[model samples]
Target: MENSRFWRDPAVPFIEARDVLDGRHVCYARHSHESFSIGAIVSGHSTYLNGRARHRVGQGTVVVMNPGDVHACNPLQDQPWAYRMLYLDTPWLTELQHQMGLGAHQDLRTFATTHSDDPRLFAGLNGLYATLTNADLAPLAKHSATIEFFTLAQQCLDPLPQRAVLAHDKLGRAADFIRANCTGEVTLAEICSVAQLSPSYLIRAFKQQYGLTPHGYLTDCRIQFARAQLRRGRAIAEAALDAGFADQAHLQRVFKQHLAATPGHYRAHSSIR
Candidate 1:
């Protein structure tokens, strides 16, 4: 795990991420993912092969591979290399295209940019990787940040940009529903129905419009609910359960993740003030 690391969260299922800190010994046979793949060379050099084309890539180079596109990267001359990559589920990305008004029919389309050295793109990809890997961030922030990054990737990497759909405020219902039921399990289906919005639309645009995903908003609601319980001198375990977390530990983890403080610390401090 020292040289290679992978990050995934069920909360954000549309994407998977991985990185290689030292790829000199790492090698891949011609391979493909059913998902859309994009990556950046963080440091070092390697030979990139896509279809019949081969190119020498170095730091700052960004590469892309569509679903089923056989490609591989290997170190050149046994030299040290490093990289970070993201694999995005095709359906999720295509639906995002539809939300962006890329086509009348929501369907996946191929992008032509095989590779580039755009500094902005390189920095964006790296930033996204960092954000996704940070465990302390809330799930809503993770998912929303993902959508924002991928949206940027599409418009900036594609040779032709699509016309963006006009903004809409239909997400309020979804937010309200989430707030109303913050202490309970809520599905994407439930939110979509309430908001009269597609999953992709809600996923990508909700944070843009409201500054938080329904899940993030729900988490905040739960935290606030727990805070109220704690103010009444209730037990932390009881507060967590009432707030819809599995148990005190679960709530403690999420509480620390969002607030960077333990429930005990918050509870003890609140009593003094």
Candidate 2:
């Protein structure tokens, strides 16, 4: 089957959309971007990771990622994963938020959870992606679809809470260090040093706070970076080196283990459109 199709309409410059078929075996590393993204799982099942929480997402699941949120998804067992995703730039989304009566504060708007089973949101986002990518669609129709999608998204996905827990500050610091150094070798000692906690303490605390070990978190980060490189048409060997993997084979192994698809397959099938 065709691996994936990605495109951005000139009319909707702020959004990029992708449709993936047979992605249940595909895995993504922990990563983030400067845009707000939403995905609707049209078929198959996968596990979604957002922060420390994990959700089993299947058909009709709608996943949202706020800018800079560390998250990933992969298929369950050998099941086929298929979905459609839209990435909306921050400025564009901010405008939509304001139009939806969300105050002008960009920072105040955020998707609280990683995924939802909202049928309405799934339909709205799916239709919006399709409409935006249709070159023959009228501008007015695209505009209407964009508005309707954002309105539904904003209504369904809640904003981040205002309060922070003092106890988790160290964990946050550790995560930040990992993210910053994800494309390089990261060690437990280094993380502990940064967090100012002992190794055992940090390990337990980090897992408790983020639902993954430090090493697991770092792996997710590297994989995410590698995916970005591959999307840009980089070679498998180069992407592996850049993402801090031991070698191309290692990257391939990890990529398939988490994402079910090979780097070469992904690269060959992707196009800017």
**What lDDT score belongs to each candidate, Candidate 1 first?**
0.76, 0.78
Deviation from native of the Cα of residue 186 in model 1, angstroms = 42
Q: What is the TM-score of each candidate against the true structure?
A: 0.58, 0.74
What is candidate 1's lDDT per residue for 86-177, written digit by digit as tens? 88988898888888777647457667677889888889899988888887888799788888988888777872344333267577677678
- For model 2, the local distance difference test gives 0.78
lDDT value, residue 178 of candidate 1? 84
**Which residue runs of candidate 2 sit more than 4 Å off their true CA positions?**
8-14, 23-35, 43-59, 65-82, 88-108, 113-117, 135-148, 161-167
